[model samples]
Target chain A: MSTALLHTGTHENQTSLAKKKLLPYWLLAPGIIWLTIFFLVPIYQLISTSTQTQGYGIGTYVQTYRFANFMDAITSSKAQLFRSFEYAFLATCFALIISYPLAYAVAFKSGRWKNTLLVLIVAPFFCSFLLRTVAWEQILGEQGFVIKTLRFLHIMGAQGHLTATPFAVVAGLTYNFLPFMTLPLYASLERIDIRMMEASGDLYANALTTFRRVTVPLSMPGVVAGTLLTFIPAAGDYINAELLGNPGTKMIGNVIEARYLAIVDYPGAAALSLILMVTILILVMAYVKRAGTDELV
Target chain B: MVDASSSAHGDLILKNLTKTFGEFVAVDDLDLVIPEGSFFALLGPSGCGKTTTLRMVAGLEEPTSGTIFIGKSEITYEKPYKRPVNTVFQNYALFPHLSIYENIAFGLRRRGVKDVDDQVQKALDLVELTHLASRKPNQLSGGQQQRIALARAIVNRPALLLLDEPLGALDLKLRRAMQIELKWIQTEVGITFVHVTHDQEEAMTMADTIAVMNEGKIEQMGSPADLYDNPQTSFVANFLGQSNLIKGSIVDSSGESAVVDVFGTKIGLPVLRNHAHDSSVLVGIRPEKIRIAPAGTQMNGNILEGGVISDASYIGVSTQYQVEMPWGQELMVFEQNDDGTPPLSKGDSVVLSWSPIFTFGLAGDQDVNAGSEAHPESE
Candidate 1:
């Protein structure tokens, strides 16, 4: 009789346990189904398309498993690939250099004006992205004051112009994504207790030493997050290169865009797109790991 | 365990130190002298200027009009890093990114010390945290991090170490253990330490001299026993410990003794010991100093009769009673539970008695509860 009672208790517990275990999966069903349909299925299609070969007609392809398409795309457009990384790296560095002090001021010194200053930092976003890029075009144009000042200072050659140059492209990238860099840095710096800085001074460190030893290291998480936010999108950007840069400064993004649309090369575009996506994923994984900010990943 | 007369090289003297934020005064015309190698405590409820005074000494805050001297060098205008003082912040402010070893070595490295490892290792050993030398500060428990903060400040060997509620973040058990450990460390190092805390027990346990502050001024400054036995202000009486203050007026004054009348009874006060401002005075007595007995018992010295027990609480080592006197004032009395008498219940008529020598006098013109009012924690 005791064995029978124990068996009944176990049977009841098993039913409840099964129901409890199914609750989380049932809650997760909507998100999982959405991602599978909208994200994973497209990625699968892209992978399959990347291995296809060009067909006899325009806008057509065959499932030939032409893995060599990726190699061909890389060899042909290696300069653009390298330039994309170079421009992105330089822009990220400039954004960081410019944002650190601004973020610090907003975080620590703005006092009653902190909110107003933050709004000012984000005010440019009210305009469309393309409109902002076009605005930069006018500012850096040959007829604009910036170009005139460069000429007056003899910083540029007699016939030199600011627009349609590598400098303009990088500048536009820096300006467009600056808030992305500033906000995270402001968040991290704001979280630093002022007591820590005072304690640093109490420990015989001068102001500069305190900044180097304490302020910079404590804000590394913000630095990692800001750099990723700026660099990842900047690397794949094509608009700046198209409008502000000359042909010599073209990036892999411009090539992939032209291959897909202007050149009508679907297989080549798919392979190039796949290579870009995979390379970014690998680089991001390695960077986050190296930064020791695993929580960001 | 701290002595005020020894180690004459590291004394701190402050004169007319004042700090004001806009129209509000934070530290008002404060004057102090901390003897060399003495563990002095600036004890007070919050907003009493103890921390402001400490900050002025550390050069973190500039005094409006004052002179600060460390063994005779006027350092009022010196920058914080230039001052020969360090502070252990209230939150333990350990650098989150640095290991325990590096955090301790920071000062040495900044000053370009040649042998950092030895100094850092010695400090680690001083705090008994050599085992955690390789761990980052965030990886350690609050108690261990507190020790690291101490080690970090002490490793610099500054002339004065200002600790701003360093144990305020720890659990009760850890705080008690650290109090003894801090006292031991002060003795071991023999460095002049100026500690600021709101905890009366912590100050009494660790300080050689405590300056009880109220309203940005020193209410009383003396050794622990002296302050407890003879508090000059009602603020000091209530802030340091619980006091049963009886409202009274001086009936007679003489060379060595004065008589104060409370209700219908005349209680004698020690003239030299009392600090009464006028005929109006508040007679004060600590709870433990008063003895309670059955209503008809004979009493000598100072006595209060016809008090009914209002409340009784059994607290293991002692029984605390709230007695309602005939004058409609409730007085607290603590009786030792040594004789194993039956516990007194509420409504039992009792007589309270204590020696006249234990009574103190404070100016009654002031609010009896002025400095003793309970305030939420202020920074």
Candidate 2:
């Protein structure tokens, strides 16, 4: 009778345990179904399309497992691939250099104007991104006030122009993704204890030393986050290159876009996309490992 | 490592040191001289300007009007990094990104001192945290972090070490332990430590001399026992510990002592202890000095008769009693639990008596509860 009683209690606990265990999966059902249909299915289809060879004339392909398609795409568009990374890296660096002081001022010295300054940083976003890029064109373009002023000051010669250059493309990328670089830095910097800075001063560190040793190191998380945010999207972006650059400055994103939409080269486009995704994964892993979150608590 | 400078060190002095934020005076023309190698405490309530004085000394805040000197050099406008001073900030602001070892070595490294491993290791050993040298500050407990902060400041070995409520975050038991540890460390290092705190007990426990402050001014500065036994101001009397202040007026003035009358009873006050300029005075006595007894019991020295017990709390060490006298004032009395007498119930008639030597006189015009509530953490 005692054993039977114990067995019944175990049975009751097992039923409740089963329900409790299944609750998390039930809660996750919507996201899982969404990812499976919208994300995973496309990934599988992209993989399938990447290895196919042309079976007939236009828009027709067969499963030939043509792995060399990736090599062919890379060989043909390697310049664009390298250019994409170079532009993204430069933009990320410039964004970080510009945003650190901006974030610092907002975090520490702005006093009552902190919120206002943050709002101003995000104010450019109220307009559409495309409209903003076009506005940059008008501001930094060949006939813009900036170029005219530079020409008047003799900083630029009579033949100098701002549009259709690598500088303009990188500048556009930096301007467009600036907010992405700023907000995370602001959040991380604002959480730092002011007492820690004063403690650094008390420990015989001058202001510059304190900033380098304490402030910068403490804000590394934000730096990492902001760099990733700026770089990833900037690398895959084609709008800025198409709007601001000449054909020579085209990136891998532009190539992929032309291959898919204008040329209808499905296999080549899919192969290039996969290569870009895999390379970014490898680079990001190495970057995070080198950045070393081990120092953070 | 902190070098104890030899000839240039005399005292940390402030001449008319003042700090004002707009119209509100934080430190009002404060003048002070902290002798070298002494553990001094600036004890007061939160807004009483003790911290403002400490911050000025550390060069964190610019004084509105004043001159500060270490020996002969004026450092009123000196940069914090340039001054030979270090402060253990409140809440143990340990650098979260740095390991325990690095945090302690930060000062030496800033001064371009290479080979800092020995000093850092010594500091780690001093705080008994050498085993956790490689761990980041955020990985430590509050008490451990507090010790690391102390080690960091002490490792710099400045001429003056300012501790701003360094143990405020610790639990009571740990606070007691750290209090003793800090006092020992001060003696061992022989650095002039200026501690700022609102905790009266902590100040009395650790300080060689304590300056009791109120309203941006020093009410009294003396040894702990001197302030307790002969408090010149009502604020000092009440802030330092529990005091029973009985309203009285001088009935006779003599060479050695003065007699003050309380309602109907006469009490003797030592002439040296009298602080009143006129006949009016407030007679102060610590609670534990007065012994409670049943009415009509024969007692000696400054007896107040016709008293009834109003309340009694039988704590483990002592039984605290609230005694109501004939004059309609409640006087507190603390009786040791070892008295071998049964606890007195409320409304029991009793008379309070104590030696006249324990009595002190303060100016009667001052508010009796001036520092009672200002004790901040007084129970």
Candidate 3:
């Protein structure tokens, strides 16, 4: 009778414990389902398509495993891949340099003007990305105000245009991704204890030394996050190149778009998309290993 | 290491330093001379400008006027980093990313000190944190973090070490332990420590000299015993410990003593040389100094008759009684709980008396002992 009572008690306790464990999962069910359907499934399909081919079983995988396509993507089409990387890297660097001071001003220096400055930084996003890019095209075209000013200054000829250049593509990318860099950096810098800097200064460290030793190290997580945000999108972005850039500045995204739409090569597009996602995932994982995400948050 | 040059002559001197934040004056003109190798405490209640005074001395806060000297060098307008002082913040503010070793070594690195390993190790050993040198700040307890902060500051061997409520964050037991440790460290390092705190007991126990501040001014600056036994101001008397302020008028002043009349009670208080005549006075007597007797008993010294309207509450080693006199004045007397025996209970009439020498007469009209405002009788 005691054994039976113990068994029944254990069963009841297990049931209650199970309910406690299941409650959180029940609450999280909708989000998990949405992520699975939208993101995970699409990624899985891309991977599967990359590995399959029409001729031999796993032929595409074998060919891709040789990395000839990657080399071809890099070398062929008039140095398209290399030029794309150069433009994206430059854009990401420029964005970082410009955004840091802006973030610092918004986060620490602006004081009562912080909210207003942040609103201004985010106001560019009020218009859609496509619309903004098109607007940039209009402003940088041959008849645009910038070209007209440059010609008037005698810095450029009358026919000088900012459109269809790598510069225009990078400028567009920087404008589009600036908020991504600034917001995270601002968040990170804002949470830094101001007293720490004061303490450092009191310890005889000059302003420059304090910044290098205390401020920069403390804001590493934000730097990593901003870099990831800007780099990933800039690497894959083809819209800027398509709208304002010439054929030479077309990125991986353009190649993928052409393969899927213009060439009707779904397999090649899927393969390229898979490679890009994997590369980004690897880089992000490496970053997370170096700078823990908890610090950023 | 104690800088022999500074040790020969006291490092810090604040001459009439004042700091005003807009309309609110945080620190009124304050003058203090902190000797080298002394643990000085800026003790006061919150918003009394104790922290502000310390910060000004450290050059963290610029004084509105007056001058500051460190080792005979004027550093009134110098920036904080340029001043020969370092501060251990209340929260420790240990660099979270750095290990204990790195945190201690940070200042050294900034100063470009060579062979920092020895200095870092010595600092860790001084704080008894050698074994935990590799651990991050978050992995350490509050006390450990506090020690790390101390280690970080002393690693630089600064001329003056400013501690801004360093022990305020610790638990009572830990705080007590740290107080001793801090004193020991200060003595061992022989560095002048200017500690800011609102805790009276902490000031009494740790500080060699206590400067009691009130409303941006130093009301009284003296040794702990001097301030406690002979509080010059009412603010000091009430702030340092509980004191019964008996409102009285100076009936007569003779030589260095005065006879003050409190209602119908006449008490003689030793007056200072500067005591004013015909002015209202406050007779400040500590609770412990006041003795209680059963009603109708003839007391040996100056006595006031009252009834024990409230029973004594046994507080570990002492029993506190609330006695109400016939004139409607309430006096609190504390009796030692000897041999765990109980004392008189409620509704018992008692007489309260103290020796004439124990009573301190403060010039009440000066608003020194009155704290915020003048008593109506004195007004």
Candidate 4:
């Protein structure tokens, strides 16, 4: 009887231990289920549709497994794809150049006003992104103070227009994504021991060299994060090209939008979307490899 | 330009150095000359302006109204980068991104010096961390990182190496080891090291000359033995080590010894050790200097009578006795265990005696408890 009781007790202990072991999986269930329904399911549907061919009737698609649609989409919208990357790359570089100094000033030099300055860096998020872009449009418009002042100072010719140009599109992207760059830069720069900069100075590095060798290199994690955050969204963006850019400044996102809404080409749109996603993945991986975040931690 | 060969190697002199942060003065009209190649220490409690003085010397902080010279060249207005001074910061501020090799090579490379490999390798070997050259700073332990920080600065071969509490983060055993190593390194490199630390033992272990700072002024500056044996101020007497101060007044001054009256008990103090501004003085004695014996037993030196052992604690190496004298002042006595005398217990009547040369007198008006506790910086 004692042997049987011991066996039963061991069995119960094993079952309870099993429950404890499964707790983490049960906790992860909600996230896994949500992703399966919302993200994974959509991806599967997108992949299946990208290979489909048009049916005999309008608004219909047949799964013909025609991989040629990807090539067709790429050939037609290749310019837009390259333009998107170029604009995004330029916008990311501009945002980084503008944000790093702003972040450094706020982090080290602000002292008592640090919190106020940080709030200012992030305060623009309270206004709608579209509204801020529209404000920029007015500021750079022909009759706006910026253009008039530049024309008066002879910095710009009388025929020079700020709106509907590649410059305007890149500027809009940079302005919209600035906070994304600045916040991370501020976090990393603020976390730097101020003494490190002092040590650099003591070690015979001038102010500019210290910034380049010590300050810039030490803030690499923030730089990488900021660049990715700005570049990713900017690459797939269509709003700036639509509102502030000329027809020549059209990006791949605009082409995808046109393919789906204006032309009713679902397969082609799906193929283009998959191509854009893959291209960004490859570029990001290559960039991360070359940027070398091995020492970031 | 700081010609490292000539201008950097001479005495570093600070003339009328004063730094004020608005309403409060951090370092007030301080003048000091740290002799060339000496391992000098600015020893003080936290915020006693020791670090501020060091920073002024390093060109990190601009003095309010002072001129600094590395032998005749005025460096007060010079930028930090232009000065031939490098600092091993308190926190070992190694560049987190750089490997140990690159960190040591930084100063050498910044000066546009070619072939930094030999110097970097020598520095890594000097710190005895040649194996850790390829690893990043975070991977190293606190002690290792500290050595790297030292290596990073010394690779530049700066004339002055300022160590700002470089061992403050280490455990006691490691801190002790680092103290000896730092002293050895200073001697080997022959740099005029201006070390700043609140730790008295660390300062005493390494510094050839120590400047004990208190509240924006030097309380006393002397060799370690001189400061410990002949402190001129109550702050120095209590801060350097433990001191048993008894209120006394000078009764007679005639030969080599001056007689002091402490609550009707006559005590002998050396005439030269008297630093009191007036006849009123606080007689100070170190705890270990005093010997304790049962009452009525014979004792030599300046003797105190009619005292009872109120407290006796037997630590491994020594016995500590707190004797309540007839005057109601409890005098501390530390007896080494090497003496074969039977251990005295609490409540036993005892006599405290020490050589009169150990008795130093300070100004009576100074606070007796000034340096017992850690004073808040700047307050």
DockQ list for all candidates:
0.51, 0.68, 0.50, 0.76
Q: Please give, for residues B59-84, the per-residue lDDT of candidate 2 as tens digits.
A: 89999998999888788998888888
TM-score of chain A of each: 0.90, 0.93, 0.85, 0.93
Q: Write the per-residue lDDT of candidate 3 for residues B263-309, one digit (tens) a residue.
A: 88787787762233456877788889987877888786678875665
Scanning candidate 2 chain B in windows of ten residues, the lowest lDDT window is: B1-10
Q: Which 10 residues in a row give candidate 1 chain A its minimum summed lDDT?
A: A288-297
Error of 1 at A193 (Å): 1.5
Q: TM-score, each model?
A: 0.94, 0.96, 0.91, 0.94
CAPRI-style quality class for the chain A–B interface of candidate 2 = medium
Cα distance off (Å), candidate 3, residue B177: 0.8
Q: Flag clash pairs in model 3.
A: B234-B369
Report how far residue A68 has shifted in candidate 3, in Å: 7.9
Model 3: CA > 4 A from native:
A1-18, A52-78, A290-297, B1-9, B273-277, B339-341, B366-379
RMSD (CA, Å), each prediction: 3.9, 2.5, 4.5, 2.8
lDDT of 4 by residue, B143-189 (tens): 99999999998888887889998899999999999999999999999
**Tens digits of per-residue lDDT for model 3 on A136-235?**
9999988688998999999998666789987899999988999999988998899999888888887778888888888888888888889889988888
Q: Can you write out model 1's per-residue Cα lDDT over A1-297, one digit (the tens) per residue?
A: 999999999999999999999999999999999999999999898889888887888888899998999999899989998899899999999999999999999999999999999999999889988999998999999788898998999998779988899999999999999999999999999998888789888777889989998898888888988999999999999999998999999998999999989998877888888888888889989998898853321
Backbone collision count in every prediction? 0, 1, 1, 0
The Cα error of candidate 2 at residue B289, in Å, is: 0.1
